[model samples]
Target: MYNSIKEIVTAANETGKTIAELTIEQECQLSGKSRDEIWQRMTVNLQTMQAAVQRGESGRGVFSQTHLTGGEAVKIKNYRASHHPLSGDVMMAAVQGAIATNEVNAAMGVVCATPTAGSSGTLPGILFMLKERLSLTKKQMIDFLFTAGGVGLVIANHAGIAGATGGCQAEVGSASAMGAAAAVEAANGTPEQSAQAMSIAISNLLGLVCDPIAGLVEIPCVKRNAIGAGNALIAADMALAGCTSKIPTDECIMAMDKVGRGLPASLRETGIGGLAGTPTGQAIKARIFGNEV
Candidate 1:
């Protein structure tokens, strides 16, 4: 929503409030609800998602992940046995379940951006960890989401969010940037700090490839989320500590775009090269596609 860093910073400072507060205010205005009501609604939404996951239906939108606790996994599996439609959280849970079961996934529905389904667990997982560990209030969580949204919007606007078009940079890179910005906001970081966090995340993942094994979102995708989530937290910490990027957010985004564009088609989720082209990858593809590699 903000066109520039200055605009974002100015807006955050205008009310002498954090970006989360501003974002919640905006959401309240749009929804015509009081802050308390909005917070309650968010809580109910999360609870509903949990219930849906328990019922074997994916409740949340894209990129949702179930809690990683053992009890949570049991609940998710019970829900799946009931034939519930997969919500984003449930979908993510299924991916995690696959990882636990040491199997591969079929089709992966990417979250907000087109990161593989397996990697979708990272952002929500980090958000959940923050909320649970820090006991962040609803307002804080929404504000974090808003802050992350800013970063994601920038990536979507300047670079590209589709993995098919921009490879893993558009997917995992953008997710990491969003996660970093959100983490910084949750830590009560300044707008500049949040932007810096995003820059660090994007810079780190500048030229990541999208090489799903056998055209499946499994293989490297599931594990990548955990790595991305950790990187996002680290980036946020560094930025909050006053570390700055030599590249501006916009320039960093542009660089990501350029790098993504230069990636070979085989590395862009086409399943023609990268890991997807390996002998094991071919074997997996043959098994899944029922055709000769």
Candidate 2:
């Protein structure tokens, strides 16, 4: 199996296989499962994501116990219905889907964590929206996830994936990169273009910290996922348009790991710095926990 982003790209180039095909082959080898079985599971993941989006847009059971994240998806939908959106359908849908998935996670509902729950929203948000925007078939949508998973596998093995270990740069940044790679492939770009998309995406989010208010993945995490989805879309479009990253994809992932390691602990999901340390953030924590700020 390909271990690094470079290797993944090399294998795809050598075999003349799509990123999705390489990833699916690796998954089959790793899991000892048939291709049909793996495909079926990914289909279930897509269905779950679609359901969370629907629930989020419906504005039902969207609130958490702390009420930190909820109803934002519905608000976006309502705004779109009334006013002409400047961002257009795909972006608007991506934002809505991202927020919806995170809101579901916050509400303790079911969600398919593309890599991790805190960063889960990016993939589904863009994937489902692109399904309509690009007129992709179900098979193509599943292929998108596999392509993204290839990137994630490389990052997780080479650098890291958890915010606790590598800060939000590892979590949301990796997820955004993965989504961007997948989007490039889904749009019929080559494996090399997908890797470039991932590089561009992660490079832009290099130092993002993982500061959750009250240690809850609600405050900035939810909104950050929305932005991550947007970043993925932009990066994918850039790559498809023949834009390239000066830094290679593997080097970008390594840089993200280094940045995360250099970050202070307060910024790594500690809830003691960044936006979580703001006066309003402290007050919200106090209000939620019944403690003085």
Alpha-carbon TM-score of each model against the true structure: 0.72, 0.96
lDDT, candidate 1, equals: 0.64
Best by lDDT: 2
C-alpha lDDT of all candidate models, in order: 0.64, 0.89
Count steric clashes of candidate 1: 7
lDDT for each residue of candidate 1 in 70-176, tens digit (9 for 90 to 100): 23334444555676544444344433332222111212222332233444555665666677557888666666666665556657877987778888878778878
Worst 10 residues of 2 by lDDT: 59-68
**Residue 35, model 2: Cα distance from true site in angstroms:** 1.5
What candidate 1 gets wrong by more than 4 Å, as runs, is 21-119
Cα distance off (Å), candidate 2, residue 259: 0.3
Per-prediction count of colliding residue pairs? 7, 0
TM-score of 1: 0.72
lDDT by residue (tens digit), candidate 2, 141-201 = 9889899888898899877888888988888888899999999888888888999999999
